[model samples]
Target: MVVPEHRVFDPASSDDRSIYDRLVELGGVHVFDTTATQLHSLRALLPTPPEDVLGEEVRWVHYPWRRSLVRVLGPRGFRLLRLDRNRNKITAAEQDDMARLCVGVVGLSVGHAVAHTLAIEGLCGELRLADFDDLDLSNLNRVPASLFDLDINKTVVAARRIAELDPYMSVVPYPDGLVESTFESFMDGLDIVIDECDSLDTKLVLREHARRRGIPVVMETSDGGILDVERFDLEPERPLLHGLLGDLDASALKNITPEQKAPLAARILDPSKLTPRMLASVPEIGRTLSTWPQLGSDVALGGASVAAVVRAFGIGTPPPSGRIRINLDAHLAAISEVEPTASGESISPANQPR
Candidate 1:
């Protein structure tokens, strides 16, 4: 596993000067100092006036993967400034509450987007990512990765990106992927689990463990923007995948090959509800298509939708357990229809906007 390396340096400490000097000498380092802007925002967001002598304690964070060093305020001030814009929408108290959550995500493809949104929004304090596969060139179409990231483990790639976005966030990478032996360690202390992996068997196993622990599970299938929120936390006895598999034991599907996963995956993501393109593409996965087609647009929407559900869960207003769709194509199709105008009025055909 290629773990991400980072360190915080307090310039006032003589003990940290030697290593900081070495990093400077290594060269090719990009330095960023935004404490001035941060302080400006921090003071504005505070309820009451702070101390007369507001001494600024700046910290420098070094990311070896990107070879960049950034300067910012201390943790409290940094978080306040970084997430200041989320105020009112996600009040200061709510933001603080979210920071205490530990979210685990399996399957780094769509999981990558979920983790990115969670990190960007400061939705969780710690994130655990699991995926055994490495980045392939074909994944670039939907995955936000480049040629330089080729061959890197998916978990490592997502973790490094999250670290770069928020060094304050704690990211644990499971490059070896999830298995029966490692399941206990992965489930330990997870407040919520997001399933994005492709394996039908792995999906069942994740839900089973989460149900036993009474932790909610969130899943978003990029097809038709299908989002499944199973609130096992509230309904501990809720059937796995909403009982779509009909009492199918996860153990029976263990070690199943990729060829066998397509049909099962379709069952979870009902084929009849899929978009015409996706429904058509499903049958050609091993034939005409490389794999089930996934658009970057749909994946991006899935990320935002998943983050919305997680935020609701974080704020103590969890949505009911059910499969919901936020299909853009369907919405667009509705827009093309001629519905009655607001005020019981109807626009003439010639008056309609082109």
Candidate 2:
């Protein structure tokens, strides 16, 4: 929808004392703070208020900020004002357009961070989140959660976090994860989809469905903050993984065991590009861990990267299809293991911490 441009009278504006008078008369409220945030109401963003103004319409909206509730009022007294804290960073026009788009994300392991990043940055106005997994003690490292969140579904936790940040943004949680029953509703009307799921088959299925609908999918890899964009919307014939996994159709990926997943994933990701630790662990799948290694630091970086990429795509300036690998190791110094020197004495390398 084209957002109609109309002049808004700010109650706090030096040029508009009439606006403040009108607000006081209409039982409107404004934040008591000196920071001059625009007065807003429960229907702050709505195009128009209903004819029957309920008794609650006179009530001041109390927003939970910091440690207390901050009471603020609406700006719909004499003029329609738009609430935008993003300012020059995100233009009012862009924000208006962004508010219409729906973005869905699957998996709340690493995806929890992605959900947080997007919601906080206002990159997506509506987020449909799916994940059957509950928060474990291990998830605290990467998921931006506290001990209080343990035992709760990751999707529910993420939704609460987003609500805390931006209550105006809509967040729908799928506690059961994405299943055949919820597929259509989850993907419906979404401009783009985020695939951060751990399962290979699910990822393929998501991409396949998204491709058919001409909806682009953005996936962030945990190791190196790799941003994978399959612009199936622009290039409908483009294969999943950019056709890297040749002839590895959805049928081949379905019903596969973890042991079977190891080699196939190695091909799609090019095992040479994987970290030494991850590369070593893939072969030990049945013997050791059931899933790939993931780090909190990498998940954080990947989440941030996805937020930026989604904004670009949402604004119609999407990055080209391919991988953009951002390796933190290149920037931050990491410890190296001791190795045997030429003389056979064990020694630490220059990069290794003493």
Candidate 3:
């Protein structure tokens, strides 16, 4: 009968004795027999076979000493020796690339969902989370936070939760979300920027900065199930957000107070830049907003999906960028390859003289 390797019997512990006796009664022999000759013979069998092969012998036989040894030693133990017996789905190169990626996520509401998904997918190494807002009763409706987190700042909540999930991960939290004062500090050393902020001006500012630095910017708008990607790397000169405002330059647009920027940016719709049919549909869209509030589930799903795409991008995986739109309501998704142009070639979307 072939015996397993790395088995030790502890006679001092009652629990160990009970386990040993049960195994012995079940026709199991300890790998190291007590006979003096057996000890010399087993020692002669130096450099034992691989742990997986040895593990199979003891798989059915439970010995507290061996189990405890394996538990304490981790992968050095019998069970962990068999871990490589299974095939690896992800290639070593891909894992290496994922390990090197550092992504910064802005806005913890939907951003948390994105970060959670990326961590689960094993795509990010370091995550810089920025958010000024605190957890409120209203946030629980859509964010990943628990009811117990109410009233705590969002950055603190996200950092704590993510740390618990992945203790090895590096999470840098900026309790204050991006602002003109904090912009320079936030943009430093980020590989990719995720624009989950609720302000259009903030999005524009982020896009400009990303464009200037040749960083890619991805934005998800839950209202229309839109996942827009501005690959500044591909088209450094293209106006940000696909020139959504038609001809209005950021400077030409009415100067908005910081307090008013959030909501006004949300409601500001540049109809001219949209397809004529879509432009006509705006009135209908307005009516829908007046009649029914946007569903939280829809927004949450949008955020999560966009985050997945971004993770794929970060890990050397191709993302469906260049203006990709996925409309859950219509079950339609499309991608448009944008052509790069000179920065001053076209009039600012908002500044096109009417």
Candidate 4:
């Protein structure tokens, strides 16, 4: 029998490693994108290193995980203790409350951004992540990942990113993707569910399950920065897809093709609200491109935006429930004038802004 990961990893140990010890241990920490990090010797960095809780002469500690042995700086509890500034926005009590939240994120393409943002804000205590897809060069357009992460399973990639940010955050990854057996468990105790998966079947099924349990669901679509919120807890009998999927049954949704999903997406999201480019591209998907167009900015903002809404929910002040659209094209669209050539032709690349 396969043992569940929770049974194997001690939560208390993970907390200690992240908070008190060197997070970088040879193989456990990797160098990606930029140049390899060069750290001064531990003693050199801290000329007069402070002692640990024991009050003994203390310095560095070896990281607990991974195959290779490596050592680096401190049992830095002092630095962690000095995070009073975080208390300015999130009160000490609220910070503690944030740590108790259990969030479920399905689909890592956009979910990775959501997961990483939550960790940075010290939001989730436990994250239940599900994704079956593998990263490719194409994924870099949205996911804030390195070329090194290419080909890695999306769930695992999100888990690793979460760990790097908040080691204390317990991340349970569904690398095989969400299926029948584990589906129920995935929904059991989530404070909120962030649904970004493409599978229409899973979307409906998840909303049904979450609605029954009174858990709210939030979704961010790729185009025009559209975010849909279903407060199923407040409106228990709310229909799936806000009753958009009323006629269709779950079986019809199973193993659905992209062609089958297009009209449905257009319906729920409203084709009129779709960008002109996206509206035009939908018909030529298979011919011009393999999938829909999404940018790193949109996905990143989507995650951060979800974190803000969820943070409000976690603390006592819940945000207004409904669709929220942060229009990037409208807000951050570039304004530039074409450089004129001596002959009134196109200018050279060198003439463009650096």
lDDT of each: 0.85, 0.71, 0.59, 0.71
TM-score per candidate: 0.89, 0.72, 0.60, 0.75
Compared with the true structure, what per-residue lDDT tens digits does model 2 show for residues 64-158? 22222233233232112333445556765776677677899999977888888887766766888998888999778678889988998888888
Deviating ranges (above 4 Å) for candidate 2: 1-85, 333-354
Which of candidates 1 and 2 reaches a greater TM-score? Answer: 1
How far does residue 315 in candidate 2 sit from its true spot (Å)? 3.1
lDDT of 4: 0.71
Please report the candidate that would top lDDT against the real structure: 1
Error of 3 at 91 (Å): 3.0
Ranking by TM-score: 1, 4, 2, 3
**lDDT (10s digit) by residue, model 3, range 300-343:** 77667776666567546656346555556454333334443466
Q: Which stretches of candidate 1 lie over 4 Å from their true place?
A: 1-4, 11-15, 26-28, 44-49, 52-56, 255-259, 336-354
Instruction: Arrange candidates, best lDDT first.
Output: 1, 2, 4, 3
112 Cα displacement, candidate 2 (Å)? 1.2
Cα distance off (Å), candidate 2, residue 11:
19
Model 1 lDDT tens row, 1-354: 234578778888887777788888988999888878877777776563254323557788998777888887777677766787787899889899999999999999999999999999999999999999999998998889888899989998888888777777889899988987678989999999999998778989999899999999999999889999999999999999999899899888977754566778788888789788877777777777767888899888988999999899888898999989999888776664455677877775445778
Q: Which candidate should be chosen as best, given TM-score against the real structure?
A: 1
- The alpha-carbon deviation from the true structure for residue 338 of candidate 3, after best TM-score superposition, in angstroms, is 37
